[model samples]
Target: MTPSLTEDGTLPAPAGNVIVVEESDMVDLFGVWDLVMVVSGVAWHLFTVVIFGWIVLRRHHFPPFRTRNLRLLGFMLACGILFWVCQVLTSLTTGRPNLPRAVCVLISPWLAYGLGLDLYMTILAYRLYLLYWLLVLRYPLRQSRRFYLFPILLGVPTALVLVSATASPRLVSTTHYPNPGNCVYSLMYSALCVVDVMIHIIVLLCLNYLCRHIEATYNDYRETTFGSIAFILLTIVAVNVFIWIGIGPPLYGYLFDREEYLAQFCVKLAADGLSCQGCHRRVDGSSSARLSYPPANPLHQHQYQRPTLPPGTGSYGETRPNDDNNSGQEDGRGTPGCSDSRTNGCRGGDDSLVEMAPTSRGITQQPADKNGHIEEWSLAHVAYHDDESNQLADKDYTGTSSAPHPPQHDRVIIE
Candidate 1:
């Protein structure tokens, strides 16, 4: 039998193979691939870090930051940074010579746990956006901070990370070539990718459902900022799914690949920046749409007219004369049962015959009967009735005689 390959040794070609590859060729290949991964990973992460930093620093420019959803999104970006750092360190340490084993051990768990947490936070950020949209539409659903924040953002992800760590404490372990280096870690990483794929699918479904609901419910759906953000999120999820499928499998140590990280970084940067922009637009729109009510002015009270009674009706529905009869009555100094002098004004016919004077403060109730006592009515009910009374008092004073109304009489009637 042919000699078996050692654990750390390179594998020989198959018997039928004619080409012979040199050891130098294999070393060069591995070195080139590792360098590519490191460079690409660093560039992608640096770009993402800069974009996220800008968003956070200038969050005030985005009005949605005033809402809780943007705060959750900010937290998610923070988790993404942590995940990227741990993943980059782990990838750098692996398949490299002269690295401290202790450092690898420390980074491995963090990378695993951070991966889980980051995935959870991304889901949470989108979910919060949905909730906020529903709230703005006045949907009757539970949106308390205790309900969404502590339980979903804090409790569930922590539990998942703890359980995953406990179940797979040695998530990454060193291995020799020919046996495939760190095959177990690669498999675990692939599992994470699979989970991410599932999450993206769920998110896609939710976004589609929400978009449809919004389109059906709102007339200005296409013009809304939330609608634009929803579309962006849909695109991001689709891109994420494609990246996961392309690089997630560990068929040949492609798990946690640099290309995959770069794809994710681009998607996140676009989504976050667009979301902030949408929020800023929404704030501007709402402020411009607000309606303001004018304050009440007592001087404008004369513009309001009260309902009028029929021609023959006096104050409080008492039968009275037409204009001709009123002129005859005025010439006789008053009506038959009235004894008041013409200069003294009407009095004592009915205590309810009252008139309102439009004062600087408001309408003031004064008895039409000179000897009648004054009583106040609530301002809330004064508008309709008081305006009518003022009109009637003006007619009585002017129509009572053909002479020009005295200036003192005008002040007393309208003061």
Candidate 2:
């Protein structure tokens, strides 16, 4: 850090690994950089809160991946506030003076620095799970959100909190600085650096995975969204490389603590930003733009756009009420059912139509003008549509079926 203080007749330069100068002198030694870091952390938190609030107020869920999303982000923000509360309480009690080394160590916010950071990582982890499900499962959340995905999302961080609470006292410690009147905590002192690096590495891996998947799946994905994420990913990687600097021991190892905050801010920024990119956001970077989709509409709603007339079967692709050979019948609305066996458009009992799937963040819809019905789609619908729609049994007037029906019969009222 600061140039040798001994040269300026100040307290002799910090000697050895630990501060040899009296603890009281350490306060003035902290200097200005500490204030910059504190301010940066506070500012980022406020900015994230503002963004979170805007999303909540608008009832915008771009990806529509999960319900109560705004509620979930709100709860996370509230949990983060508790840490600031702890810091305030700690400051009020001791005022961070020439307290014994042991006293400050005991009072430094444990949950805030230790478990809290891990909790934030969970947000990034969700993105990873989103991609994994898409690549392998074909349909997101098809395996059972209640028994599997939901529990993992909620329980993993919860489990970490429990373990951290039990183990923190033994694994975490703090260094008190009088000048700034604060206690800087480290998880197990310097050793926690390794743990911190491990966490970031995992985050980096997740980002890398996300980028690769994005390239493969959303090759023509809106460039604005993809570019923003790519910038974030590159920025993080570059910063990490600069800090580590080479294949051996870091040439700039000392700067890690300084750069870590920036790196972390970027990571969380990417996560929060992704929450909005799933829907609405367009190539022009406008959320208010009219909804448009790529050729592969994820919900497979395009098939219902126009009822194609069967070859020489009939006009309007509809079997009249007096068709003597008619096997399929019509509903009161004159909508065709699978009763007509002459045409390939007719269904038997159960045939695949289109299945609604969750998006990355928000829900979208397209209106079938001729069909007089609106079809809903999610942001990540492109990743969802399949040749074989989820087979649904048809037993009632509103019942769904797997029967191969012509575009005319593909229409159904979504309830």
For candidate 1, write residues 87-142 as lDDT tens digits: 65665554443333344444544444445454544555355445545644555456
Alpha carbon lDDT of each predicted model: 0.40, 0.41
**Model 1's lDDT to the true fold?**
0.40
Single out the weakest 10-residue window by summed lDDT for candidate 2: 377-386
Residue 306's lDDT within candidate 1 is: 32
The residue-by-residue lDDT of candidate 2 on 1-415, one tens digit each, is: 6666566688664554554435565434333755665677688888998887777766475655233255555655765665665554454544344444345444442455443544544543444455545554456566666436542644443455345534554433334333233344454544553455366446546544554545534322243357558979999998887566563232232245423332222223322333323222222343211221221434533322222334533322433333344425554323343343443544312232322222222223344345544332222222111123333432211222122222321211111
Candidate 1's TM-score reads 0.34
> Each candidate's TM vs. the true structure?
0.34, 0.33
In model 1, what lDDT does residue 269 have? Answer: 34
- The regions of model 1 sitting more than 4 angstroms off are 1-48, 62-70, 97-109, 112-117, 120-146, 149-158, 166-183, 186-193, 196-200, 215-415
